[model samples]
Target chain A: MIELKNVTKQYPGQPHPAVDSLTLTVPEGEICVLVGPSGCGKSTTLRMINRMIEPSAGSITINGQSVMNNDPDHLRMGIGYVIQQIGLLPHRTIAENIAIVPRLYKWPKEKIVRRVDELLVMMGLDPEKTRSKYPSQLSGGQMQRVGVARAMAVDPPIMLMDEPFGAVDPIARTHLQDEFLRLQKEIRKTIVFVTHDINEAIKMGDKIAIFGEGKLVQFGTPEEVLTNPANEFVENFIGYDRIVKKLFLYQVQEAYRPAVCRLRPEEIGNALSKMLAEKAEVAFVLNEADKPCGYLTREELEQEETARDADGLQKLAARRSKAFVQTTTPLPDALSVMLEYDAEYVGVLKNGLLEGVMSFKDIRRHVYRREGE
Target chain B: MKMSWERFQIALFEKAPEAVLTHLLIVVITVALAILISVPLGVLLTRPRYRKFGVVALNILNILNAIPGMAVIALALPILGLGIKPAVVALLFQSLLPIVRNTIAGLLEVSADVKEAAAGMGMNQRQILLEVEMPLAMPIILSGIRTSTVYVVSVGTLAALIGAGGLGNMIIGGLALFMPEYLIVGAGLGAIMSIFFDRALSYLEYKITPPGVRAN
Candidate 1:
């Protein structure tokens, strides 16, 4: 655990402290994202944890030991740090960059080499192809991945990441964020993430600490902060789209309703009867093993008057790739899949088996019910 | 013309071979000493507390640089009392400005992000300076050394004025005796040496520059 007690950082001439007397505790194996507008001392607080920026007053302890007791270099070596610019040493190849800490710790040569290749693979880069390439040779996304890989080279238990994905284009940023999230699930390192983008905070933070000026205005789980903002500033910071943003925090499985009308590809008459009796808009067509094969809309079913036709509902079903969403997909993504395919609903699948289906109506109802409460 | 060529060969191979050797020796020693003194002095000036002192030191060196090489040698003559010693000292002072100024400039040109990353990654101040800052600043610093080397070689000719044996002796002696061959041999060899040293250092600069930062 990382704990700060009444930490304050006051510049010599500045009237207000850059970071006021603030205290925060980050539990083991959790990500605490520090977020606010520019110059709110979010970065200051992060630097203080590693002793890069010493606080004027108060104590900081990592893993229950006072940070002051350790040498700054020794302390820093034990913590991973990544920044916005992805500061990989331009002169060094990707492998050398990743080997920095491990080499610093005086690991055996083979061990360092092994770790470098391991981290490259972990960051989704092909080690043999990338190990010898310099930072300048890589794209912005690749450089950012290498930056993260370098930070994790020594497997430091705590990581301090300051807007690590801020420099990439939106498409690459999303890709990097997904890869990092997947990597984080496996590593489970205690991380202190700093970002100003609220959506990013909601997406990656296990708990978000909202800062205003030099003080933390609110610190809570994304659900708590979104559902019950501490004050007007936080509410304003979260913006008017908080309701919709909350949907990103929920998975498709959480809001999906069991399909009322599901039918095998051959059972066209039964499919039509179920759609009619249930007044459903779409009927999911299943294959022999009960996996979602395609879907048929009531409009298409009505046009096909002959239910006993050889092709039956199978021919009428639209096998759109966008119609499929996994159970683990966030509701916002599921909604986007619906919009992308121009479909009324999306099938939620687990291991190729149809668990249920979700529509905009289901997400809206779920979000609205939470809002009402 | 044939007589001048015969005289030039005799002057270069027999009469003044020692002058040529001494001239090369003086240039090498002066440049080596200038590099040893100025590179560290340049690095020292870049430190935050010493930065102002560095500016003041550079200004003093700039004044020294502005002075004519002959005048600097003349000034050194009275204090050190002549020969290769005072001449070497004057040339050393003359070369200081380029190496010092270029070292400071090269170090300063390193991006703030690179330094922060070095520190954040647990590199101490010395490691950051050596492994990160120095390697990045090398191309610029080597350029400075090249300039200093050329200056030292050209100025070493002036050491002959204070009874220092160099190619300058031939030029001075040839003018007095009206021997055009002596002048050509001295001036010709000096120019060739300057070009040779400059090219060598330029090659060094190219080789030491990090591949990622090498100009296209």
Candidate 2:
């Protein structure tokens, strides 16, 4: 556990402290994301944990031991740090970059080599291909991965990431975030993540600590911060779209309702009866493997001029656009696919098998229930 | 007085090799001493505590550099009194500026981000200098050494005025006797030495540069 009690950082000449007397505790194996607008002291708080920026007042302790007690170099070596500008040494090859902390610890040569390769693989890079390559040779996304790999070299118990994904393009940022979330499940280091984007905070943070003008305004789980913002600043910071952003926290499975009318492509004759029985405006079609291939609207089925396949069954329109989400996909992402395909509901799949559907109505119902609560 | 091939052969064969060796000695000793003094001074001046002194020290070096080589040798003659040692001391003064300036420039040119990363990785100040700063700054620093070396070789010919007995002795002897052969041998060898050292150090500079940094 990392705890800061009444910690403050005041620059020598500046009137306002960069970080005011603030207290926060991050429990073991949890990610505490520090978030705010620019110059709000989120980065200052992170640097203080590693003593890169010393706190002017109060104490910072990790696992009940004061951060100030140890030699600063020794203290920093035991903690992992990553930054917005992925700082890999230009002089070192990828393997050497990852080996820095381990070499500092004087690990055996064989052990260091093994650890370097292990980290590269863990970070999804091919060791043989990337080990000899220099930082300049790697793309931005690759360099960021190597930066994280280097930080994790010694398996430090605490890692501080200051907008680790902020430098990547949006598509790569999403991939990295998801990859890290998966990696965190197994590593479970106490982490203090800093980010400006609320959606990122909600997605990656086990708990979000909101800062404003060097003061920590609120610290709670994403659910708490979104549902019950502390004040006007938080409400505005969380934005008018807080209701929709909250959906990112929930998986498609949570809001899933079994699709009322499901038909195999060969079972198209029963589509009208199935929709009538369940009062569904649309009927989902599944293939022999039970994967959702398409859907049929009641208007299309009711039309006499509707096209049919060679088997005398009504043709499935919008066939196999992959308009489905895995059961584990976030509701916001699932909602995006719904919007993209212009559909009322998105089919939820488990291992390529159709499980159910989550509709716009289900999301609205979920939001209404939370708003009432 | 005629430019005779026989006299040229005599000058080249009889006196050329010894004068060339002595000239080489003056330049090599002067450049070596300059490097030893300048590199450490440069590193020290760049350190936070001593950084304020850097501007003062560099200005002094720049003034020393501005003094002509013959005048520096002439000034050294009174204090050290006529020898290869006095000549080397004079040339050493002339050589210090380039190495010192380049070393300071090289160390400063190491990007702030790279140094921050080094410190963030828990490298102490010493390690950052040895592991990161030095390697990255190497090519620039070596080019300074090259510049200093070539300047020293060209200037060592003036050492003969103080009886230092380098190729300058040959040139002075040829001037008094009006022999074109002696002048050609002395000046030619000096020019060739300057070119050799320049090319050699350039290769060294290229070789020592870290491969990743070479991409830039």
Q: Tens digit of lDDT per residue, candidate 2, span A217-307?
A: 9999999899999999999999999888888888888888875578876677777777888888777887777666777777666784545
Model 2 interface RMSD, one decimal? 0.8
Quality of candidate 1 docking, DockQ: 0.77
TM-score per model over all chains: 0.95, 0.95
Docking class of 1: medium
Worst 10 residues of 1 chain B by lDDT: B1-10
Least accurate 10 contiguous residues by lDDT in model 2 chain A = A308-317
Q: Write the per-residue lDDT of candidate 2 for residues B113-150, one digit (tens) a residue.
A: 77877788899999999998888888998999999999
Candidate 2 ranges with C-alpha deviation above 4 Å: A264-267, A278-282, A297-313, A316-321
Cα DockQ of the candidate 2 complex: 0.72
TM-score of chain B of each: 0.95, 0.97
Considering the two chains of model 2, state its CAPRI-style docking category: medium
Candidate 1: segments with Cα more than 4 A from true spot: A275-282, A288-290, A297-316, A319-322, B1-3
